[model samples]
Target: MAGPTPDELRSVVDRFPTPPDAEAFGRADELLDGTYSAIAESWYPELRRLATAYAEGDVLRESVLEHVEAVPSFRISEGATPLTRRREALATAAETLDSVAEVSAWYDDLRTLLADSPDSRSLLERLLHDFGYAAAHVLFLGASSPEQVVRRLRWAYRTVGVRIDSVSSEAGTERTTFTCPYRDVAAGRCGKRWVCHEKLDRVDDGYVTYLRERGIDYQRPRGCAESERCHSSVARDGPSQWWPKTPPSAVEREP
Candidate 1:
């Protein structure tokens, strides 16, 4: 008989018992480190799936596996926790969704995972940052009508207990305001209060970039992360037209 081929080897490895015990988790850690054969790359997906099957449920196996695989090798910090790494991976996956249906499906998985893992505040912030950009691109970039856009955005956030207060347009101007779920949802996750504020700021930047790309003017003044209530406004006119309408701030007035 021929020596075990890669597929045969993989089959045998897959058959290895996957129990929810310390030893299995240790095996996962070893597998993640490429401790087995030289064909570690090929085994990664299967290992992730097995790991998920052992930890979470079978339904989440694929989603969790995809989430774990999305993290490029360079992105995983040397000392980061596995949970942190997985969350970042999920952010990359969630942000790359190309359609409304895809985005909705991702949000469903993410919402449930976040609720079950409350200590994942930092991860939640990362997801929201990417999600804001994705949402803006999908809704504001001709994917849906303004009404549908607002409704979809509201629905996504509501799944996580966050409310999108307003999304409206008037005389070629659009403005939106919403409460920051991170404030309540991620209260004890971080060591400092300012860290939470920083997270909000970053997410707002993603939103602002989305509007800026489409020649829309975003009118949120100062840092939004500092405020419990976040808000953003956009004018339909291009950047050139929007720039002249607003009064100059003290920074701009300085000699």
Candidate 2:
């Protein structure tokens, strides 16, 4: 597939709530952009090295790239209520880490299987496990807070098997209907701390008006490039005029 268009990427990102502060968003954007760049730049070389060791050659490299390119974008607006905001942030973080972890696990397995000889299998297996752990750690470190990262990573791994068929399918309903342990309704860490079980509704005129009152800018472009620009702007200067009026907060708080 031709890599995800900017629009597709934005659609993924637009699903999550924005950070409460411009700096948070900026840092998150930087981390995301850097992660994307690192994968784009190093994945091929790393794949090539691993492929050579396993004798799979470029085929493995190509496969990995195809998988990475297939990842859907995810984003959420910060217009949600505080409870919703917390839940969305946790969910978004967990999902993002899960994607990276899954990819890492797959690569590790491939690497182990490709070992040059039977003698290499043990070493390769260890290496692969380390690699997978490292990949997850990289994501965790890039997150806004270490505690949040750890919590979400644990949640993501535990809930890996659950599935949501489609966003459009779930858009009109409340999150309580979902039957996963990770669902925010179970009075667990996520339920008590995040709002994962909140309902989602269409952005009606009233909601839009609310956003306007808050000074959030909502005129998002439907195209890919423009969408990237929109994210870039928010990453740099916070949201435009259509989101809630809460000003961006500082990055470091004792909390």
Candidate 3:
């Protein structure tokens, strides 16, 4: 799973704090970890089997999905106590959309399982694109301006331990750190490209996708590797630029 969720992140604020049920939040995380493991255990093998079936001919996407199950799904009731159920429902958002490790594992699984199939690389790319697009939707949408992006991302990134420093009229958002937990995960095994392109770029790209949908231009953010803090801009498109033009201090107003 990913880090603490948007709900869990509701407390990950310094400026305007809305402390979540700290106990419930931790419980939700444990539930998610368990459910994720259950999904992998129950479905990964079956999925590999189905991949063989798909290589044979036309397999309905639904057919593949019918066999996949993760807990706390909409179709089923978790029936956790009222207090816990809300948190558990919130945990659903933590599913494997943005997980680089899970994504790469899927890549490996599909490649290994479907190696003998025709145009497998193209097929893999198509699958990955579909998955990535879906993942981006889970990032955010309907943001009104660059400031909205900053406001939302400011708290959301807190789960990953990032702190927003400022956002310029030009849509450049200064950050206390561009580094994420992913950078440290399996540090020795994964290279710079995997950490940056696969893990980090997805976060930037999700915002880019949403901005582009509104016909707003966006320049993806970049962080300084050498400095303690990385300041980057979100710039794109024509003369009419838009961003949350609030001064940095304004970001910390009382909730």
Best by TM-score: 3
The global C-alpha lDDT for each of the candidates, from Candidate 1 onward, is 0.41, 0.30, 0.39
lDDT of 3 by residue, 95-124 (tens): 312231232234334333322222432444
Candidate 2 lDDT, 81-134, residue by residue in tens: 233443344333334444433333443344333222324324433344345444
Q: Per-residue lDDT of 152-205 in model 1, one digit per residue for the tens?
A: 445545765656776778865555777755654354553222333435544544
Off by over 4 Å in 2: 1-33, 49-91, 94-98, 114-255
TM-score of each: 0.32, 0.19, 0.35
| TM-score, model 1 to reference | 0.32
Residue-pair clashes per prediction, in order, are 0, 22, 3
* Evaluation by TM-score, superior candidate among 1 and 2: 1
Q: How far is candidate 1 from the true structure (C-alpha RMSD, Å)?
A: 20.9
Q: Write down the worst ten-residue block by lDDT for model 3.
A: 241-250
Off by over 4 Å in 3: 1-132, 135-139, 165-177, 239-255
Which has the higher lDDT value, candidate number 1 or candidate number 3? 1
